[model samples]
Every structure is written in structure tokens, then in C-alpha cells.
Target: MKKFSLLSNRAGALFLAPGAILVALFVIIPFFWVIFVSFTNRTLLGRTAVNPDFVGLQNYLALFNPETFFTRGQFGFSLILTTQFVILSALVGQALLGLLLAWLMQAVPKPLKAFTETCVIAAWILPEVVIGFAWFAFLDYDNGTLNGILRSIGLPGADLLLQQPFWVIVFFNTWRGAAFSMMLFNSAFQSIPPSYFQAADVAGATSFQKFRDIALPLIRGHVVTDLILITMWTFNVFTPFILTHGGPSYRTELLSIYTYRVAFKDFEFGKGAAVGVIIMLINLAFALVYLRIARSRNKEAEQ
Candidate 1:
């Protein structure tokens, strides 16, 4: 029996070895490499390309420098813009709208609920390139579908991308991501006992009252999870580049797009690595908070 157990363990190790090696080569090594590069003056062009010098903290300092910190196209500006984008698109738009939709679906007819879910999920599952181009066509100024409709209705067409690029991406991201939150909240709501809502109904509670007093409390953990996940996803989303290319003078340049522009576009590998490190740290903080909340929830469940 002991010999068989040892053989089984060896077999398991053999099965896992390939995956473990791949992870170390792709994920772990690259992670540390980025950190190391951040402490250098590396670039993809010119002198630094081949003989990059160790300029510890200079890249980070330049990112936070007082002279250019708040300037347009700077790191600080992108950070602030990314913060606003996450708050508006993830926290406010996706979470709130998803909660509302989930609540409404509970009282909706089955067919309507299914149809709504299908439509929302379609938005989520469609290819990003397809969705981006579809939106661009809809929002185009001269010959777009939206402008055509507006002209037909005697309403003036507005140049949304050029005029309100930030809000455009916010709306785009909200529409793109709300399906996940909606589905999560829907599942959370389903986990809730019907008796609680029945009791609320017996007490002549309104829809809003039941949602506020009963549903919300039951799904509080799910809400926290949804918010954290969506915030992180929104923070790192680069799909908006397809829509606006972080353009119209950098109005919609979120941190992800900013990093891409710095690293790949400008070939400033060191500075880009610094920005990547900061983003990683921010995501780490979010992950830590999420784990803490999840652990507490598990403890409560156990108790």
C-alpha cells in the first residue's frame, strides 16, 4: 500500500510539472523582471536599449514629479482619470444598475427576464473589437447610425467621442461590464430564502422596502465582491483604446492605456515598468481587501 501511494504521488507530480514550469517561466519570472526593470533606465530604443543603466527610483520619482505630475498625458493625470473611471463606470454605473436590474428581474415574468438576460449577456460575451467598432459606428459624427437617426428626428447630432470622450468610455465600460454584476447579484439573490421576501410581502412591504430591508442585507457580501472585481477590471481595462484610442487629446487616457503608450508606443520600458508596478500594487491592495472580506464571510458562515 505504501509503495502504491508513493507511485500515485509521483504520478501527480509528473502531471503538474509541466504546468508549474510554464507558470514560472511566463508569470513568475516576468513579474520579477518587470520590477527589476522599473529600477533601471531601460528603453527599446537608443543607448538604454542595449546597455540600460541602474537608475534606481528615478523612473518612479519622475512619475510623481511636481513639475509634470498634473500635466495632461502625465502619470498622475492618468491615475486620477483612472480613479474617476472606476468610480463612475464600475462602482456607480455597473453596481447600481446591476443591482436595480437584478431586483427588478425577481418580480419580472420569466420570458421577459430571460430575454433581458440574453441581451445583457450578449453585450458581455461579444468580441471586444466587434463591440468597439459597433459603438464607433453608432457614435460617428457624419455618417453614423446615431447621427442618421438624430437627423431624421430633427435633433442635432453631437460629436460624442470628441466632445465627451471620458464620459463616453465610462458609459461604454458600464454597458460592457454590468452583465457580470447583474449575474452575480442575481445568483446572490437566488441564494436568499423565499420565506424572507414572503414575510416582507405579508407585512405589505413595497418593492423598494423589501429590497432595502431584506434583499440588500442578504446579498451584502456579493455586493462587496462585485464592486471589488469590477473596480479592478475597470482599472486595467484597455478595450477603451479601441473605442477612443485614449485620444481626443488624452481625455480618456486611463492608466492601462497610459502604460501601453509609455512602454510600447514611446518605447520607455523602464518608466512603463514603473507604472506597471504601481498598478500591480493597487491591484494587490484590492485583492487583499477582497480576501479579507471573503475570509470574514467564511468565518461567519462557519459560526
Candidate 2:
């Protein structure tokens, strides 16, 4: 029995040891380091945290400052408000767009469907810098695709990045993000049983009625999943801010960009760490809500 137990222990370790070591090195260690560094006054180029004082709560306090973490001006809001807007706008827009694309793809022919799917996924898989540059050039005032098209229609020239920063950011996010939702909803739609739609048809249900009563309910799980996942992505979106640099007088500044600027640009390591922790907490909340919704759906499925 003792020999058998020793072999079993060795087998278990063989299975678990590699993963455990990876988790410790990549996740656990880095997380603890960030937390530790959050208590100190640090700089970007410094060998160690400057003034290594354990200033408890100071970093957190600075976050609430009217300008430091948020509005760079007198406004009482900035990162939090802008971040919420980005999350909501991107998630809702993408979900709705995905649902439409899913339904359309279902009705379309296979060849066209394949072509569209390829295009959408290609966009999603494209390098961020490539897309970022493409968007930047597209939004440029003098030699932009959009401006050129606008000029053809006799519209005035204006650098969209400067004229409408928020909407431009929102547009860029939605354009790039809708494809993931399309993929998610497309899978959900395909997973739905065809018999139900046939049954609805035999019952003389209208197209809208069938979709409303059957398709939407059946795809609820995918919708919830997409929303949660998209919310997380949109929340952590730094690419938008990086391309825009939270620019045009900080109109496009969001939490992720704000944290990056604080930690890397301003050299306030502790405050940056605080911002990073807060972001993790916000993402965690979204994750919990997603899990709860998924659990509820599972119960319904079982019943």
C-alpha cells in the first residue's frame, strides 16, 4: 500500500508540477510584486522604488483627485466615466451587430457566408499596429480615405481625430470589435436545433415571431458570454488610447490609458500599481456577473 501511494503521488506531481510552476512564475509572482510596489514611491528609470516609504492609502487617495486619475481639469470625472462609456458603447453595439450578422449569415448562401466569415475573422486576427495605422491614416484630414470620400460629396475638410475624438474612438472600437461578436453569435445560431424552427413553421408562426420566441431565447447563453467577454476586452482596451494617446486634450482618455500614463509616463509607480489593481477588480466583477448568468442558463437547460 505504501509503495502504491508513493507511485500515485509521483504521478500526480508529474501532472500538476509544471503548471503550478508556470502559474507561480507568470501570474502569482508578478501580481505580488505589483502589490508590493504599489506601497512605494517609484519611478520608471529608477533602480529601486524611490523614497521607499510605505505610504498606505496615499496612492488610492490620489486616484480620486479631480485631475490626477480623472479629468485633467476641474471636471469631477474622467477615467471612470470615459471607461464606462467605452465599455457600454462597444459591448452593446457589438452584441447587437453580432445578432444581426448571425441572423443574416444563417439566411445567406454558403459561398457568401464563407467569404464574409473569412473577412471578419481576418480583421480580428490582423496585427493591432497594422489596423491602428490604417485607422489613423483613414482619419487623417489632408490625405485620408474618409476625408477624400467626404470631399467627393462636397463636405468640408476636418481632422476627425480633432473634431470628434470620442466618436472617432468609439467608431474605431466598434469597427474592429464587431467581428468577434459575429463569430460568437454565428456559433450560437448554428448550435440551435433546426427542428425548433421547423416546428415553429409548421405551427404557422411568423418569421419575426419565430425568431423572437425561439432564436433569441436559444442564443441567450452566447449573448451573455459575448457581452461579458466583450466587456472585459473593452474595459482593458489600451490599443485605442495608445493609437489616440488619450489625445486631443484628453477627450479619449480611459482608465487603461490613464493607468499606463500614470505608471509609465509620469513615473508614479505606486499610483500606477493602484490603478492596475482597481482595473483587475473591475474586470473581476464583470467576470462574476458573467459566471452567474451562465450558471442560471445551465440550470434552465438542465430543467
Measured by TM-score, the strongest candidate is 1
- Cα displacement (angstroms), candidate 2, residue 21, comes to 2.2
Model 2 lDDT tens row, 1-303: 445464587888988999999999999999988888777767766655545668888777777764543446211245555566566566667778777887889888999999998987887899888888898888888898988999999988788788787787777778788899999888887888899989998999987887799999888778778888988888777777645788867777777777877778888788789878877788889999998998998898899
lDDT, candidate 1, 39-99, per-residue tens: 9999998998999999999999999999998999999999999999999999999999999
Tell me the lDDT of model 2 at 295.
90
TM-score of 1: 0.97
Q: Whole-model Cα lDDT per candidate?
A: 0.94, 0.79
Q: For candidate 1, give the lDDT of residue 80.
A: 95
Candidate 1, position 32, lDDT: 100
- Angstrom error of the Cα, residue 52, model 1: value is 0.6
Cα deviation of 227 in candidate 1 (Å)?
0.7
The Cα error of candidate 2 at residue 87, in Å, is 4.4
